[model samples]
Target: MIYLQLFLSYLQIGAFSFGGGYAAMPLIQAQVVEKYHWLSMTEFSDLVTIAEMTPGPIAINSATFVGTQVAGLSGALIATLGCILPSCIIVTLLAKIYIQYRNVKIMQDILGTLRPVVVSMIAVAGLGILSSVFFLSGKFAPALSNFNIRGIIFFAGALLCLRKTKLSPILIMVGCGILELLYQTIF
Candidate 1:
Protein backbone atom coordinates (compact mmCIF):
# COMPACT_ATOMS: atom_id res chain seq x y z
CA MET A 1 0.00 0.00 0.00
CA ILE A 2 2.76 2.40 0.91
CA TYR A 3 4.68 1.52 -2.24
CA LEU A 4 1.52 2.03 -4.28
CA GLN A 5 1.06 5.44 -2.72
CA LEU A 6 4.62 6.33 -3.48
CA PHE A 7 4.22 5.21 -7.06
CA LEU A 8 1.09 7.30 -7.56
CA SER A 9 2.57 10.34 -5.91
CA TYR A 10 5.64 10.28 -8.09
CA LEU A 11 3.57 9.56 -11.16
CA GLN A 12 1.69 12.77 -10.58
CA ILE A 13 4.91 14.64 -10.03
CA GLY A 14 6.45 13.28 -13.21
CA ALA A 15 3.39 13.94 -15.31
CA PHE A 16 3.09 17.61 -14.39
CA SER A 17 6.70 18.80 -13.97
CA PHE A 18 6.65 20.88 -17.16
CA GLY A 19 9.73 23.11 -16.92
CA GLY A 20 11.76 20.66 -14.79
CA GLY A 21 13.96 21.04 -11.68
CA TYR A 22 13.13 24.10 -9.61
CA ALA A 23 9.83 24.36 -11.41
CA ALA A 24 8.66 21.10 -9.91
CA MET A 25 10.10 21.73 -6.46
CA PRO A 26 7.19 23.62 -4.97
CA LEU A 27 4.70 21.02 -6.13
CA ILE A 28 6.73 18.22 -4.59
CA GLN A 29 7.04 20.19 -1.37
CA ALA A 30 3.33 20.70 -1.21
CA GLN A 31 2.60 17.06 -1.95
CA VAL A 32 5.12 15.61 0.47
CA VAL A 33 5.01 18.19 3.24
CA GLU A 34 1.51 19.60 3.26
CA LYS A 35 -0.68 16.91 1.76
CA TYR A 36 0.99 13.77 3.10
CA HIS A 37 3.06 14.95 6.07
CA TRP A 38 5.89 12.82 4.74
CA LEU A 39 8.60 15.40 5.35
CA SER A 40 9.09 18.75 6.97
CA MET A 41 9.99 21.89 5.06
CA THR A 42 13.52 21.64 6.42
CA GLU A 43 13.80 18.07 5.16
CA PHE A 44 12.51 19.21 1.79
CA SER A 45 15.12 21.98 1.79
CA ASP A 46 17.79 19.41 2.51
CA LEU A 47 16.46 17.26 -0.28
CA VAL A 48 16.60 20.24 -2.64
CA THR A 49 20.24 20.83 -1.71
CA ILE A 50 21.16 17.22 -2.28
CA ALA A 51 19.25 17.06 -5.55
CA GLU A 52 20.81 20.25 -6.89
CA MET A 53 24.24 18.87 -6.09
CA THR A 54 23.54 15.65 -7.98
CA PRO A 55 23.41 15.06 -11.76
CA GLY A 56 19.80 14.31 -12.63
CA PRO A 57 16.45 16.08 -12.63
CA ILE A 58 15.39 17.35 -9.21
CA ALA A 59 11.96 15.73 -9.39
CA ILE A 60 13.41 12.28 -10.11
CA ASN A 61 15.99 12.65 -7.35
CA SER A 62 13.32 13.72 -4.90
CA ALA A 63 11.07 10.83 -5.91
CA THR A 64 13.79 8.26 -5.47
CA PHE A 65 14.98 9.63 -2.15
CA VAL A 66 11.58 10.14 -0.62
CA GLY A 67 10.28 6.84 -1.91
CA THR A 68 13.20 4.93 -0.46
CA GLN A 69 12.82 6.68 2.86
CA VAL A 70 9.15 5.85 2.96
CA ALA A 71 9.30 2.20 1.91
CA GLY A 72 12.82 1.07 1.19
CA LEU A 73 14.00 -0.59 -2.04
CA SER A 74 10.62 -1.50 -3.48
CA GLY A 75 9.49 2.06 -2.94
CA ALA A 76 12.55 3.36 -4.72
CA LEU A 77 12.05 1.11 -7.74
CA ILE A 78 8.35 1.82 -8.01
CA ALA A 79 8.76 5.53 -7.62
CA THR A 80 11.56 5.71 -10.14
CA LEU A 81 9.54 3.73 -12.64
CA GLY A 82 6.52 5.91 -12.02
CA CYS A 83 8.53 9.06 -12.50
CA ILE A 84 9.89 7.80 -15.81
CA LEU A 85 6.71 6.30 -17.16
CA PRO A 86 5.15 9.50 -18.38
CA SER A 87 8.22 10.58 -20.25
CA CYS A 88 8.66 7.12 -21.69
CA ILE A 89 5.12 7.06 -23.02
CA ILE A 90 5.25 10.57 -24.37
CA VAL A 91 8.57 10.08 -26.08
CA THR A 92 7.58 6.76 -27.55
CA LEU A 93 4.46 8.18 -29.09
CA LEU A 94 6.19 11.29 -30.30
CA ALA A 95 9.02 9.34 -31.86
CA LYS A 96 6.66 7.01 -33.66
CA ILE A 97 4.47 9.73 -35.14
CA TYR A 98 6.84 12.66 -35.07
CA ILE A 99 9.56 10.96 -37.07
CA GLN A 100 7.26 10.48 -39.99
CA TYR A 101 6.05 14.08 -39.94
CA ARG A 102 9.00 15.80 -38.36
CA ASN A 103 10.03 17.52 -41.60
CA VAL A 104 6.59 18.81 -42.33
CA LYS A 105 6.38 22.58 -42.42
CA ILE A 106 3.62 22.80 -39.80
CA MET A 107 5.43 20.58 -37.35
CA GLN A 108 8.69 22.43 -37.95
CA ASP A 109 6.92 25.74 -37.43
CA ILE A 110 5.38 24.58 -34.16
CA LEU A 111 8.68 23.32 -32.78
CA GLY A 112 10.48 26.49 -33.81
CA THR A 113 7.81 28.55 -32.11
CA LEU A 114 8.16 26.51 -28.93
CA ARG A 115 11.89 27.11 -28.62
CA PRO A 116 11.64 30.66 -27.31
CA VAL A 117 8.70 29.79 -25.06
CA VAL A 118 10.74 27.07 -23.42
CA VAL A 119 13.59 29.51 -22.86
CA SER A 120 11.21 31.99 -21.28
CA MET A 121 9.85 29.32 -18.95
CA ILE A 122 13.33 28.45 -17.78
CA ALA A 123 14.06 32.10 -17.05
CA VAL A 124 10.88 32.38 -15.02
CA ALA A 125 11.80 29.30 -13.00
CA GLY A 126 15.25 30.69 -12.27
CA LEU A 127 13.83 33.98 -11.04
CA GLY A 128 11.03 32.45 -8.97
CA ILE A 129 13.36 31.34 -6.19
CA LEU A 130 15.23 34.62 -6.02
CA SER A 131 12.64 36.12 -3.73
CA SER A 132 12.64 33.05 -1.52
CA VAL A 133 16.41 32.77 -1.34
CA PHE A 134 17.72 36.33 -1.18
CA PHE A 135 15.15 38.95 -0.34
CA LEU A 136 13.57 38.90 3.09
CA SER A 137 12.06 42.36 2.91
CA GLY A 138 9.08 41.04 0.88
CA LYS A 139 10.38 42.46 -2.38
CA PHE A 140 10.09 39.82 -5.12
CA ALA A 141 12.82 40.80 -7.54
CA PRO A 142 16.59 40.66 -7.75
CA ALA A 143 18.38 43.25 -5.63
CA LEU A 144 22.00 44.05 -4.85
CA SER A 145 21.80 42.50 -1.38
CA ASN A 146 20.71 39.06 -2.58
CA PHE A 147 22.62 38.67 -5.80
CA ASN A 148 24.22 35.21 -5.80
CA ILE A 149 27.80 35.35 -6.98
CA ARG A 150 28.24 31.63 -6.44
CA GLY A 151 25.22 30.91 -8.60
CA ILE A 152 26.50 33.24 -11.30
CA ILE A 153 29.88 31.54 -11.31
CA PHE A 154 28.30 28.14 -11.44
CA PHE A 155 26.04 29.07 -14.36
CA ALA A 156 28.69 30.87 -16.38
CA GLY A 157 31.35 28.23 -15.80
CA ALA A 158 29.00 25.41 -16.53
CA LEU A 159 27.79 27.07 -19.74
CA LEU A 160 31.32 27.71 -20.94
CA CYS A 161 32.43 24.24 -20.01
CA LEU A 162 29.60 22.63 -21.93
CA ARG A 163 29.86 24.93 -24.92
CA LYS A 164 33.60 25.50 -25.27
CA THR A 165 35.17 22.36 -23.81
CA LYS A 166 34.62 18.64 -23.70
CA LEU A 167 34.53 18.36 -19.90
CA SER A 168 31.74 16.33 -18.35
CA PRO A 169 29.15 18.04 -16.16
CA ILE A 170 30.17 16.04 -13.10
CA LEU A 171 33.78 17.13 -13.45
CA ILE A 172 32.72 20.72 -13.96
CA MET A 173 30.47 20.57 -10.92
CA VAL A 174 33.22 19.13 -8.78
CA GLY A 175 35.64 21.81 -9.98
CA CYS A 176 33.09 24.53 -9.27
CA GLY A 177 32.45 23.14 -5.81
CA ILE A 178 36.14 23.28 -5.03
CA LEU A 179 36.26 26.84 -6.36
CA GLU A 180 33.33 27.67 -4.08
CA LEU A 181 35.22 26.37 -1.06
CA LEU A 182 38.24 28.41 -2.01
CA TYR A 183 36.19 31.51 -2.66
CA GLN A 184 34.65 31.25 0.80
CA THR A 185 37.84 30.39 2.67
CA ILE A 186 40.27 32.73 0.95
CA PHE A 187 38.17 35.61 -0.38
Candidate 2:
Protein backbone atom coordinates (compact mmCIF):
# COMPACT_ATOMS: atom_id res chain seq x y z
CA MET A 1 0.00 0.00 0.00
CA ILE A 2 2.82 2.38 0.78
CA TYR A 3 4.54 1.32 -2.41
CA LEU A 4 1.43 2.08 -4.39
CA GLN A 5 1.14 5.48 -2.81
CA LEU A 6 4.73 6.25 -3.62
CA PHE A 7 4.23 5.17 -7.20
CA LEU A 8 1.12 7.29 -7.62
CA SER A 9 2.75 10.31 -6.04
CA TYR A 10 5.80 10.16 -8.26
CA LEU A 11 3.65 9.42 -11.29
CA GLN A 12 1.82 12.68 -10.69
CA ILE A 13 5.11 14.52 -10.29
CA GLY A 14 6.58 13.01 -13.43
CA ALA A 15 3.47 13.79 -15.40
CA PHE A 16 3.25 17.42 -14.37
CA SER A 17 6.96 18.18 -14.24
CA PHE A 18 7.48 19.35 -17.81
CA GLY A 19 10.91 20.96 -17.89
CA GLY A 20 13.06 18.24 -16.33
CA GLY A 21 14.68 17.54 -12.97
CA TYR A 22 15.09 21.04 -11.60
CA ALA A 23 11.56 21.94 -12.63
CA ALA A 24 10.21 19.06 -10.58
CA MET A 25 11.75 20.19 -7.28
CA PRO A 26 8.75 22.17 -6.06
CA LEU A 27 6.36 19.39 -6.93
CA ILE A 28 8.53 16.84 -5.21
CA GLN A 29 8.85 19.12 -2.18
CA ALA A 30 5.11 19.62 -2.02
CA GLN A 31 4.29 15.94 -2.30
CA VAL A 32 7.03 14.48 -0.09
CA VAL A 33 7.35 17.20 2.50
CA GLU A 34 4.14 19.21 2.62
CA LYS A 35 1.52 16.74 1.41
CA TYR A 36 2.76 13.38 2.66
CA HIS A 37 4.96 14.52 5.55
CA TRP A 38 7.26 11.69 4.56
CA LEU A 39 10.19 14.07 4.94
CA SER A 40 10.66 17.33 6.74
CA MET A 41 11.62 20.36 4.63
CA THR A 42 15.18 20.07 5.88
CA GLU A 43 15.30 16.41 4.96
CA PHE A 44 13.82 17.14 1.57
CA SER A 45 16.44 19.82 1.02
CA ASP A 46 19.18 17.41 2.02
CA LEU A 47 17.66 14.83 -0.30
CA VAL A 48 17.77 17.36 -3.12
CA THR A 49 21.39 18.09 -2.37
CA ILE A 50 22.28 14.42 -2.41
CA ALA A 51 20.23 13.91 -5.53
CA GLU A 52 22.04 16.72 -7.27
CA MET A 53 25.42 15.27 -6.37
CA THR A 54 24.48 11.77 -7.54
CA PRO A 55 24.91 10.50 -11.08
CA GLY A 56 21.36 10.70 -12.39
CA PRO A 57 18.30 12.88 -12.81
CA ILE A 58 17.39 14.76 -9.60
CA ALA A 59 13.82 13.47 -9.64
CA ILE A 60 14.87 9.83 -9.92
CA ASN A 61 17.60 10.24 -7.34
CA SER A 62 15.20 11.90 -4.93
CA ALA A 63 12.63 9.16 -5.44
CA THR A 64 15.18 6.48 -4.81
CA PHE A 65 16.50 8.15 -1.68
CA VAL A 66 13.12 8.98 -0.20
CA GLY A 67 11.70 5.60 -1.06
CA THR A 68 14.66 3.76 0.39
CA GLN A 69 14.46 5.82 3.56
CA VAL A 70 10.76 5.06 3.87
CA ALA A 71 10.41 1.47 2.67
CA GLY A 72 13.81 0.00 1.73
CA LEU A 73 15.07 -1.47 -1.55
CA SER A 74 11.77 -2.42 -3.14
CA GLY A 75 10.42 1.01 -2.39
CA ALA A 76 13.39 2.61 -4.12
CA LEU A 77 12.75 0.59 -7.25
CA ILE A 78 9.02 1.29 -7.21
CA ALA A 79 9.42 5.01 -6.59
CA THR A 80 12.04 5.40 -9.29
CA LEU A 81 9.88 3.58 -11.77
CA GLY A 82 6.92 5.77 -10.86
CA CYS A 83 8.93 8.98 -11.24
CA ILE A 84 10.19 8.05 -14.71
CA LEU A 85 7.09 6.28 -16.05
CA PRO A 86 5.26 9.43 -16.96
CA SER A 87 8.31 10.94 -18.61
CA CYS A 88 8.81 7.87 -20.74
CA ILE A 89 5.21 7.82 -21.91
CA ILE A 90 5.04 11.55 -22.48
CA VAL A 91 8.28 11.67 -24.46
CA THR A 92 7.17 8.82 -26.70
CA LEU A 93 3.87 10.54 -27.38
CA LEU A 94 5.50 13.90 -27.86
CA ALA A 95 8.06 12.50 -30.27
CA LYS A 96 5.32 11.28 -32.56
CA ILE A 97 3.43 14.58 -32.40
CA TYR A 98 6.61 16.62 -32.67
CA ILE A 99 7.78 14.74 -35.75
CA GLN A 100 4.52 15.39 -37.49
CA TYR A 101 4.32 19.04 -36.50
CA ARG A 102 7.94 20.01 -36.31
CA ASN A 103 7.23 23.22 -38.16
CA VAL A 104 4.03 24.21 -36.44
CA LYS A 105 4.02 27.68 -34.95
CA ILE A 106 1.69 26.66 -32.14
CA MET A 107 4.07 23.99 -30.95
CA GLN A 108 6.97 26.43 -31.11
CA ASP A 109 4.90 28.98 -29.28
CA ILE A 110 4.09 26.51 -26.54
CA LEU A 111 7.75 25.66 -26.14
CA GLY A 112 8.65 29.34 -26.00
CA THR A 113 6.10 29.99 -23.28
CA LEU A 114 7.43 27.09 -21.25
CA ARG A 115 10.95 28.52 -21.20
CA PRO A 116 10.05 31.27 -18.71
CA VAL A 117 8.01 28.90 -16.59
CA VAL A 118 10.94 26.53 -16.45
CA VAL A 119 13.23 29.36 -15.41
CA SER A 120 10.77 30.34 -12.69
CA MET A 121 10.61 26.78 -11.43
CA ILE A 122 14.38 26.55 -11.32
CA ALA A 123 14.56 29.85 -9.44
CA VAL A 124 12.05 28.63 -6.89
CA ALA A 125 14.06 25.45 -6.43
CA GLY A 126 17.22 27.50 -5.90
CA LEU A 127 15.51 29.63 -3.28
CA GLY A 128 14.17 26.53 -1.57
CA ILE A 129 17.67 25.12 -1.36
CA LEU A 130 19.07 28.40 -0.09
CA SER A 131 16.39 28.63 2.56
CA SER A 132 17.10 25.15 3.75
CA VAL A 133 20.82 25.71 3.98
CA PHE A 134 20.99 29.29 5.21
CA PHE A 135 17.95 29.61 7.43
CA LEU A 136 18.30 27.95 10.85
CA SER A 137 14.53 27.53 10.87
CA GLY A 138 14.83 25.52 7.60
CA LYS A 139 12.10 27.61 6.01
CA PHE A 140 11.60 30.65 3.77
CA ALA A 141 11.15 33.09 6.61
CA PRO A 142 14.51 33.28 8.33
CA ALA A 143 15.15 35.49 11.31
CA LEU A 144 18.31 37.60 11.11
CA SER A 145 19.82 35.70 14.00
CA ASN A 146 19.21 32.42 12.18
CA PHE A 147 21.27 33.22 9.12
CA ASN A 148 24.07 30.76 8.42
CA ILE A 149 27.27 32.68 7.77
CA ARG A 150 29.13 29.70 6.39
CA GLY A 151 26.36 28.94 3.95
CA ILE A 152 26.27 32.54 2.85
CA ILE A 153 30.01 32.54 2.29
CA PHE A 154 29.81 29.34 0.29
CA PHE A 155 26.99 30.71 -1.83
CA ALA A 156 28.82 33.95 -2.50
CA GLY A 157 32.00 32.15 -3.43
CA ALA A 158 30.14 29.85 -5.77
CA LEU A 159 28.42 32.80 -7.38
CA LEU A 160 31.71 34.61 -7.75
CA CYS A 161 33.28 31.60 -9.40
CA LEU A 162 30.36 31.30 -11.76
CA ARG A 163 30.44 34.97 -12.70
CA LYS A 164 34.15 35.65 -12.84
CA THR A 165 35.71 32.36 -13.81
CA LYS A 166 35.02 29.57 -16.23
CA LEU A 167 35.67 26.84 -13.68
CA SER A 168 33.72 23.67 -14.20
CA PRO A 169 30.76 23.24 -11.87
CA ILE A 170 32.06 19.83 -10.81
CA LEU A 171 35.31 21.37 -9.69
CA ILE A 172 33.51 24.08 -7.77
CA MET A 173 31.34 21.52 -6.02
CA VAL A 174 34.31 19.35 -5.18
CA GLY A 175 36.17 22.36 -3.86
CA CYS A 176 33.23 23.36 -1.74
CA GLY A 177 32.86 19.85 -0.42
CA ILE A 178 36.49 19.79 0.62
CA LEU A 179 36.22 23.21 2.21
CA GLU A 180 33.10 22.15 4.09
CA LEU A 181 34.83 19.00 5.30
CA LEU A 182 37.74 21.06 6.56
CA TYR A 183 35.41 23.53 8.22
CA GLN A 184 33.61 20.70 9.98
CA THR A 185 36.87 19.21 11.16
CA ILE A 186 38.60 22.39 12.27
CA PHE A 187 35.73 24.33 13.78
Candidate 3:
Protein backbone atom coordinates (compact mmCIF):
# COMPACT_ATOMS: atom_id res chain seq x y z
CA MET A 1 0.00 0.00 0.00
CA ILE A 2 2.80 2.40 0.97
CA TYR A 3 4.75 1.43 -2.15
CA LEU A 4 1.70 2.07 -4.30
CA GLN A 5 1.22 5.45 -2.67
CA LEU A 6 4.83 6.41 -3.24
CA PHE A 7 4.66 5.36 -6.89
CA LEU A 8 1.45 7.24 -7.56
CA SER A 9 2.58 10.35 -5.72
CA TYR A 10 5.88 10.57 -7.56
CA LEU A 11 4.19 9.72 -10.85
CA GLN A 12 1.97 12.78 -10.43
CA ILE A 13 4.93 14.92 -9.46
CA GLY A 14 6.94 13.76 -12.49
CA ALA A 15 4.10 14.04 -15.00
CA PHE A 16 3.04 17.58 -14.04
CA SER A 17 6.33 19.18 -13.07
CA PHE A 18 6.87 21.25 -16.16
CA GLY A 19 9.65 23.86 -16.58
CA GLY A 20 12.37 21.59 -15.19
CA GLY A 21 13.49 20.81 -11.66
CA TYR A 22 13.78 24.33 -10.23
CA ALA A 23 10.24 25.10 -11.25
CA ALA A 24 9.14 21.76 -9.85
CA MET A 25 10.26 22.69 -6.34
CA PRO A 26 6.86 23.89 -5.20
CA LEU A 27 5.06 20.78 -6.41
CA ILE A 28 7.60 18.46 -4.83
CA GLN A 29 7.45 20.41 -1.60
CA ALA A 30 3.68 20.27 -1.49
CA GLN A 31 3.55 16.54 -2.13
CA VAL A 32 6.45 15.53 0.07
CA VAL A 33 6.14 18.00 2.90
CA GLU A 34 2.47 18.92 3.02
CA LYS A 35 0.47 16.07 1.49
CA TYR A 36 2.48 13.10 2.64
CA HIS A 37 4.19 14.49 5.73
CA TRP A 38 7.21 12.34 4.95
CA LEU A 39 9.51 15.19 5.84
CA SER A 40 9.28 18.53 7.62
CA MET A 41 9.90 21.84 5.88
CA THR A 42 13.34 22.10 7.44
CA GLU A 43 14.16 18.60 6.30
CA PHE A 44 12.86 19.38 2.84
CA SER A 45 15.00 22.47 2.75
CA ASP A 46 18.01 20.43 3.70
CA LEU A 47 17.13 17.89 1.04
CA VAL A 48 16.92 20.66 -1.52
CA THR A 49 20.30 21.91 -0.47
CA ILE A 50 21.80 18.48 -0.87
CA ALA A 51 20.02 17.97 -4.14
CA GLU A 52 21.32 21.23 -5.57
CA MET A 53 24.85 20.32 -4.59
CA THR A 54 24.63 16.90 -6.18
CA PRO A 55 24.39 15.86 -9.82
CA GLY A 56 21.09 15.01 -11.60
CA PRO A 57 17.63 16.63 -11.35
CA ILE A 58 16.31 17.96 -8.06
CA ALA A 59 13.09 15.95 -8.34
CA ILE A 60 14.95 12.65 -8.76
CA ASN A 61 17.28 13.44 -5.87
CA SER A 62 14.28 14.24 -3.73
CA ALA A 63 12.45 11.05 -4.67
CA THR A 64 15.48 8.90 -3.93
CA PHE A 65 16.13 10.60 -0.62
CA VAL A 66 12.54 10.66 0.54
CA GLY A 67 11.96 7.08 -0.56
CA THR A 68 15.07 5.87 1.19
CA GLN A 69 13.91 7.58 4.33
CA VAL A 70 10.44 6.13 4.08
CA ALA A 71 11.21 2.50 3.20
CA GLY A 72 14.87 1.91 2.32
CA LEU A 73 16.34 0.43 -0.90
CA SER A 74 13.21 -0.99 -2.50
CA GLY A 75 11.40 2.22 -1.79
CA ALA A 76 14.16 4.19 -3.49
CA LEU A 77 13.88 2.04 -6.63
CA ILE A 78 10.11 2.35 -6.83
CA ALA A 79 10.13 6.10 -6.22
CA THR A 80 12.86 6.69 -8.78
CA LEU A 81 11.03 4.60 -11.38
CA GLY A 82 7.87 6.56 -10.64
CA CYS A 83 9.64 9.89 -10.94
CA ILE A 84 11.25 8.97 -14.28
CA LEU A 85 8.44 7.13 -16.02
CA PRO A 86 6.27 10.11 -16.84
CA SER A 87 9.07 12.26 -18.18
CA CYS A 88 10.34 9.38 -20.29
CA ILE A 89 6.99 8.77 -21.90
CA ILE A 90 6.12 12.42 -22.33
CA VAL A 91 9.45 13.40 -23.79
CA THR A 92 9.37 10.49 -26.22
CA LEU A 93 6.00 11.57 -27.50
CA LEU A 94 6.90 15.25 -27.54
CA ALA A 95 10.06 14.58 -29.48
CA LYS A 96 8.15 12.87 -32.27
CA ILE A 97 5.48 15.56 -32.28
CA TYR A 98 8.00 18.35 -32.17
CA ILE A 99 9.90 16.84 -35.08
CA GLN A 100 6.71 16.70 -37.14
CA TYR A 101 5.69 20.27 -36.28
CA ARG A 102 9.11 21.88 -36.20
CA ASN A 103 8.15 24.38 -38.88
CA VAL A 104 4.78 25.48 -37.51
CA LYS A 105 4.41 29.10 -36.41
CA ILE A 106 1.89 28.26 -33.69
CA MET A 107 4.21 25.68 -32.23
CA GLN A 108 7.05 28.20 -32.20
CA ASP A 109 4.80 30.76 -30.55
CA ILE A 110 3.70 28.28 -27.90
CA LEU A 111 7.31 27.37 -27.11
CA GLY A 112 8.23 31.03 -26.90
CA THR A 113 5.41 31.71 -24.44
CA LEU A 114 6.41 28.70 -22.37
CA ARG A 115 9.94 30.06 -21.95
CA PRO A 116 8.82 33.02 -19.85
CA VAL A 117 6.41 30.92 -17.82
CA VAL A 118 9.24 28.53 -17.00
CA VAL A 119 11.44 31.45 -15.95
CA SER A 120 8.69 32.83 -13.75
CA MET A 121 8.13 29.48 -12.11
CA ILE A 122 11.85 29.10 -11.43
CA ALA A 123 12.01 32.61 -9.97
CA VAL A 124 9.06 31.95 -7.70
CA ALA A 125 10.63 28.77 -6.41
CA GLY A 126 13.88 30.62 -5.72
CA LEU A 127 12.03 33.34 -3.82
CA GLY A 128 10.08 30.80 -1.83
CA ILE A 129 13.27 29.14 -0.68
CA LEU A 130 14.77 32.51 0.16
CA SER A 131 11.75 33.52 2.19
CA SER A 132 11.56 30.22 4.00
CA VAL A 133 15.21 30.31 4.99
CA PHE A 134 15.64 34.00 5.69
CA PHE A 135 12.29 35.17 7.00
CA LEU A 136 10.94 32.02 8.58
CA SER A 137 11.45 33.18 12.14
CA GLY A 138 9.65 36.47 11.45
CA LYS A 139 6.32 34.58 11.24
CA PHE A 140 4.13 37.16 9.50
CA ALA A 141 6.46 38.80 7.03
CA PRO A 142 10.06 39.18 6.05
CA ALA A 143 11.90 41.54 8.36
CA LEU A 144 15.33 43.07 8.29
CA SER A 145 15.89 41.75 11.78
CA ASN A 146 15.45 38.20 10.57
CA PHE A 147 17.58 38.56 7.47
CA ASN A 148 20.33 36.05 6.82
CA ILE A 149 23.26 38.34 6.28
CA ARG A 150 25.73 35.65 5.38
CA GLY A 151 23.44 34.17 2.79
CA ILE A 152 22.84 37.55 1.21
CA ILE A 153 26.56 38.17 1.10
CA PHE A 154 27.20 34.82 -0.51
CA PHE A 155 24.46 35.35 -3.04
CA ALA A 156 25.73 38.81 -3.94
CA GLY A 157 29.28 37.60 -4.26
CA ALA A 158 28.32 34.64 -6.38
CA LEU A 159 26.24 36.78 -8.70
CA LEU A 160 29.07 39.22 -9.10
CA CYS A 161 31.52 36.45 -9.82
CA LEU A 162 29.19 34.86 -12.32
CA ARG A 163 28.88 38.13 -14.19
CA LYS A 164 32.45 39.43 -13.94
CA THR A 165 34.62 36.31 -13.91
CA LYS A 166 35.19 33.43 -16.28
CA LEU A 167 35.27 30.92 -13.46
CA SER A 168 33.13 27.83 -13.89
CA PRO A 169 30.08 27.37 -11.67
CA ILE A 170 31.52 24.22 -10.09
CA LEU A 171 34.57 26.13 -8.93
CA ILE A 172 32.43 28.86 -7.47
CA MET A 173 30.29 26.27 -5.73
CA VAL A 174 33.37 24.63 -4.22
CA GLY A 175 34.67 27.98 -3.06
CA CYS A 176 31.33 28.87 -1.54
CA GLY A 177 31.13 25.49 0.16
CA ILE A 178 34.57 26.01 1.69
CA LEU A 179 33.65 29.50 2.82
CA GLU A 180 30.42 28.25 4.36
CA LEU A 181 32.25 25.46 6.14
CA LEU A 182 34.72 27.94 7.59
CA TYR A 183 31.96 30.31 8.54
CA GLN A 184 30.06 27.56 10.30
CA THR A 185 33.12 26.34 12.11
CA ILE A 186 34.28 29.76 13.20
CA PHE A 187 31.05 31.56 13.89
Q: Pick the candidate with the highest TM-score.
A: 2
Candidate 1 structure quality by residue, lDDT tens digits, 80-157: 888889878877888998989988899989878866765675565455444333444423445676555556556777
Instruction: Tell me the tens digit of each residue's lDDT in model 3 across 104-178.
Output: 999999999989988988887787677666654513355677776777788788889999999998888889989
The superposed Cα distance between candidate 1 and the true structure at residue 151, in angstroms, equals: 11
TM-score of each: 0.61, 0.93, 0.86
Model 1 earns a TM-score of 0.61
Q: Is candidate 1 or candidate 2 better by lDDT?
A: 2
Question: Model 1: runs farther than 4 Å from truth?
Answer: 19-23, 120-124, 135-187
What are the C-alpha RMSDs, in order, of all predicted structures? 5.1, 1.4, 2.2
Worst 10 residues of 1 by lDDT: 130-139
Ranking by lDDT: 2, 3, 1
| Residue clash pairs of candidate 1 | none
Which candidate number has the best lDDT?
Answer: 2
Error of 3 at 91 (Å): 1.5
Instruction: Give the Å error, residue 107, model 1.
Output: 1.9
Per-residue CA lDDT of model 2 for 1-187, tens digit only, reads 9999899989998899878899999999999998889999888878987998889999999999988988999999999999999889999999999999989999999999999999999899888888878877876554688887788899999989988999998889899999999999999
